[model samples]
Target chain A: MPVITQRLRVTARLTELARVRQFVHGCALREGLPERETFACELAADEAFVNIVVHAYGGESDGPVFVRCRGVANGLLISFVDEGMAWDPTPPSAPPWESTETEITVGGLGRLIIHRAMDGVRFTRRGNRNILSMCKFRPGFSPAE
Target chain B: MEVKITEYKRVAVVQPVGRVDSNTSAEFEAELRRLVESGRTNLVLDLSKIDFLSSAGLRVIVSTMKSTRKNGGNVCVAAANARAAEVMKLAGLDSVIDMHPSREAAVASF
Candidate 1:
């Protein structure tokens, strides 16, 4: 298969999440990914994008968040770039799903979902930009060299 | 996202059609919070029409659940699609929140 690449730049705002999902979904379909894998890819990308829009910019910055999607080999690679604050690699662990306590707690689930749904996640800060790259590989398929 | 609220045996069945992500979760939370504030503590969220679920959406659900339980009521999810179910499971929400296979069962639980 041929390599496919797409890029989108949107304001780091909560309202722009739909556009992000649309962009990712289009890319996933173009890559011919399975339904399950496409959903996983979109979820992972959504989590990462939300983190950037909500946390990276503190919901105040008017900077732009750049997203890039690439279809390579038998997998999809998605990256988010932002000029907002760098994310702390040490995210708080997600609470167990089956806690015996009656009270339910919120937070940290985004990181958990992203890490679990995607095959690989990498975060790095270069100069003033924070780059988060996530990958989703099809089952029983390896990326072509 | 389109949210449809129906009452069954005093249980508020909140159905959100479409993706519940950051873009639409504010409205989703607002609608649910309104129900909770109106003394409607029992809620059954029908997830059958929800094609996508994100942490932002989960936050709203968790907050509502906490609020409802404080008033001797609880929230249950019913008929979530496979993608939604997988997301809920990965977040461990499936355990924290009661999930039923059907709306009738979910409403009955509350």
Candidate 2:
């Protein structure tokens, strides 16, 4: 079967987060992705979009966030490209689940979540645009040797 | 976000319909913070109506919980869907707060 793909583009406004969630969730469910994994994609994608708006663009509402979700070999790829400042979001480690005021308030918590909620996260800067991609693999599937 | 607060003698159950993401988290936080400041600190968050949740929403909860705890109060979760539950669990929130199967259970815990 050919891999199916869905894409959406929206301004870097907080109001646009809902559209990103629906767009990503709809694509996952339509492709028969499991419920657990479906939610993961929805969240990971949302986190990335928020990161772009809050971090990449400094809370600016007009910056455009280019989103593209496509089915790949044994997994789904949710990618975002934007013309915002370059900052790779790959987290070194997930914050301790301690829920302390210092831990959550110091920042990088969202990055930890985006990493833990998805199977893979990759980042690259292409000239002026930043490309951040996250992957969620199908159950009982593993990359071939 | 539309947040409904059902007040009881011991606890206030806050139900928010729709998504609690970056856009709406501020509103959600405001409602809960209002309750906390009003001395209604023990809170039961009925999340059944919540369609989606993110770190922004979780941040509000954590901060609110901290505030309530400072006043010898606490917060519990009610009817959180699997998605909401999973995210909370991922954050190790289950260790810090209680998550009940229903609003009744959540309120009863207080």
* Candidate achieving the largest TM-score: 2
Q: In CAPRI terms, where does candidate 2 land?
A: medium
Tens digit of per-residue lDDT, candidate 2, span A20-116? 8889888788767899999999998888888888788978579889898898767688899999998758664644445455225523667778888
Q: Count the backbone clashes (under 3 Å) in each candidate.
A: 2, 0
Clashes of 2: 0
Please give the distance, in angstroms, between residue B57's alpha carbon in candidate 1 and its true position after superposition. Answer: 0.8
Q: Give the fraction of native contacts in model 1.
A: 0.65
The TM-scores, one per candidate, come to: 0.89, 0.91
| Model 2: colliding residue pairs | none
Instruction: Give the Cα error of residue A103 in candidate 2, in Å.
Output: 9.3
Residue-wise C-alpha lDDT for candidate 1, range A1-70, written one tens digit per residue: 5666799999887677778988998899888898988888888888888788767887736799999999
lDDT of 2 by residue, B1-110 (tens): 79999999999999999889888888999999899989998999998988888888888888888889889999999999887888887766777778899999999999
Q: Which ten residues in a row have the lowest lDDT in candidate 2 chain B?
A: B88-97
Q: After superposition, how far is residue B43 of candidate 1 from its true place, in Å?
A: 1.2
Lowest summed lDDT window (length 10), candidate 1 chain A: A98-107
